[model samples]
Target: MEKLEQEMPLDPFEHIIFDYFPVYVEADVEAFLDLTSDQEKKKCTLEIVHAGMKRAAQAFNWDLQILEKVYHTIKQTGYKSIFALLKKSSPNKKYVCSIMCHHEVKRMDVYVEIKKRSGIVVKKEKLFSVKNTDEQDLLSEYGTLTWTLNHKVEFADKDYKKVYRLTFLEKDKPEDLVWKMERYEL
Candidate 1:
């Protein structure tokens, strides 16, 4: 694993804008299975989660302590999940976007909070509510999360052309899986 890490190029800061926690968790589990000692497994899990939390804190502009608290809550809840937080800005408005995926339940939820320049949230809305279909499972056979999205989905409505198109991995199948949401205005 150290050799692999050395061979790979450094990830840019922007890469953390995507949800990669599930992949890290899955890798840690696989590594744990190969280790014979309990101490080694514990160390592996802690290292993976800590690295992930660091990236998440930078991407979300959150304090590390806050992320640790959220991680503990997720651990207590016993749900394997991935999430991303991003901030966007326009000339007149600012927004905070959140995307969360629960692999066990095969569900993903997207939300946006519209805020003023002063950082007061004015509105919150659900941008997408999606579930894994038979065609696309949230977790691949290898146990890695396989959820992704394309930001450019065409819609007849002029107000919205950026509806998301989600894709996932097909369980027990090697073919790529895709699921397009029906026309729904945001």
Candidate 2:
């Protein structure tokens, strides 16, 4: 008789965040939530988020003091709003992408814009929005965007965890982009 092999279960922290990679971090967060026991979920979530934020600060060359300020703000105001900001640096031009989640209304918004060195927004576009449900709701549809090294953005949707490569066809037109969604198991 032939021997059979069995697959092992995956570890929750296998993909822990270590830098300013929000999409992967968020995915890790989701995986952690899914795999952890209810009794330990809250504590584990806070620790993972803190670790991820620390790594992100180091990777982005942000002041460590800012992290403290951020935590203080969260404690004082509650998590009514949460956001992640990413900067794409270029020699002569700079671009920024911001993902904001409003817990009060259970909505999330994505924005990508070009900014001047002085922090003035030159042009901006709203990439997408997820509305009408809390992020933690299993039925809620949400997604994340990742900036690739090749000057392209990729979007991953929560449902089925499908990934789509976003291609900007026109330099001057943000809306003139295409999404080529490829489905595969995570």
Candidate 3:
């Protein structure tokens, strides 16, 4: 726990923006929806989402202000889906590998690009787009987004250096923004 604390400092508002990692990655939302009636499916899904959010907030001991913002964001933007990027380094830190969750929206997709470098030269690159919105254009009823062009990863672990960055791009202008970077132990 001490080393964990020293390495990857937890972000409290993570649960709000993204679904629970690993578990959500393997979750079958459609299968779960099939278990309920048409009228109850949406309701049940919302309930499950709310419950998960509440539980995550509790687990992290986040402040009320953060929770409130999360609630309002979900209320406005609607929790469409999450994009998870799992990046890991090879032994000796010479190489890196990345795995991103695949999500699809109706209209347009969000593009993601990652550049991993060992020194001055770029070592590897990973790029993809996940569709999770139906907006005709960038602007929509929900809100605008915050574009984070770069996030530096300074620390590396023993076995395989791993880090994750989650960015949210909304349609309308959102005042308070949430971006997350996390490291997982292997």
Candidate 4:
């Protein structure tokens, strides 16, 4: 994770915004010979969650302590299975974020507050939501979080085009990550 963070050429003073969401998954077992083992399903779910969190932290310039705490919280919570919409945060200096629990996953909700901000978030939106079991399963399979937006504005007879692409790999290895912003004048 440290190596990944170091590779990004982000402005130290710029505020970085990040979106957080929970992944819900279920494992069904009919018999002992069931090919889809419980452990395998759990591993897959955890990997997807971890990869997403790690990439978001890197992109938003989160502190090492914050990253550690988030990972620890997830481990404590046995991934009981729940769906949540993406929560946006404009982390600049100090902020509070949700931390999951191990026992009674839904009942043991906890929030962790951090004292420093490594980045800032510029804009936030409810990009995606998981409403039902079907959607949950679909996300669990190829659960890559991606956002693409295009906007056009006119000012004094001049036109400007803006595009933003945000992707957090859930199906691919963490080592292969490409994230950046580009500017073009028209």
Q: Which number leads on TM-score?
A: 2
How well is each residue in 1-186 modelled by candidate 4, as lDDT tens digits?
Answer: 111122344353455345433322222233323435555455455555565567556666778688778666766776455433222232321322211122221132211211114433222222223233353343243232222221211111112232223322212553563333333433
List, residue by residue over 1-186, the lDDT tens digit for candidate 1.
Answer: 331111222344545646543222225345568887645554555556666556546656778887788667766665345443344444223322233332333346544443446765444445454565221332221121112222222212223433433222223443443333444435
What would the per-residue lDDT of candidate 3 be over residues 74-185, giving only the tens digit for each residue?
A: 5565544444344545333543334334333233333333333553223222333325443322223212222224333322222233323443322243444333444454
Angstrom error of the Cα, residue 63, model 2: value is 18
Q: What range of 10 consecutive residues in model 3 has the weakest lDDT sum?
A: 1-10
- Clash totals for all candidate models: 0, 0, 7, 8
For model 3, what is the alpha-carbon lDDT of residue 72?
Answer: 65
The reply for model 3, stretches above 4 Å from the true place, is: 1-32, 35-46, 82-186
What TM-score would every model get versus the actual structure? 0.30, 0.31, 0.26, 0.27
Clashing pairs in 3: 104-131, 105-131, 143-171, 143-172, 144-171, 144-172, 144-173
Candidate 3's TM-score = 0.26
Query: Where is model 4 poorest over a 10-residue stretch in terms of lDDT?
Result: 149-158
Per residue, candidate 2 scores C-alpha lDDT tens digits across 17-38 of 5532442233244555465454
Q: What are the clashing pairs of model 4?
A: 15-120, 16-119, 16-120, 16-121, 17-120, 17-121, 77-102, 93-117
Report the lDDT of model 2 for residue 58.
Answer: 65
Residue-pair clashes, model 2? 0
- Deviation of model 2 at 55, angstroms: 25
Candidate 4 vs. true structure, TM-score: 0.27
Which lDDT value does model 3 have at 143? 26
Which candidate gets the maximum lDDT versus the true structure? 2
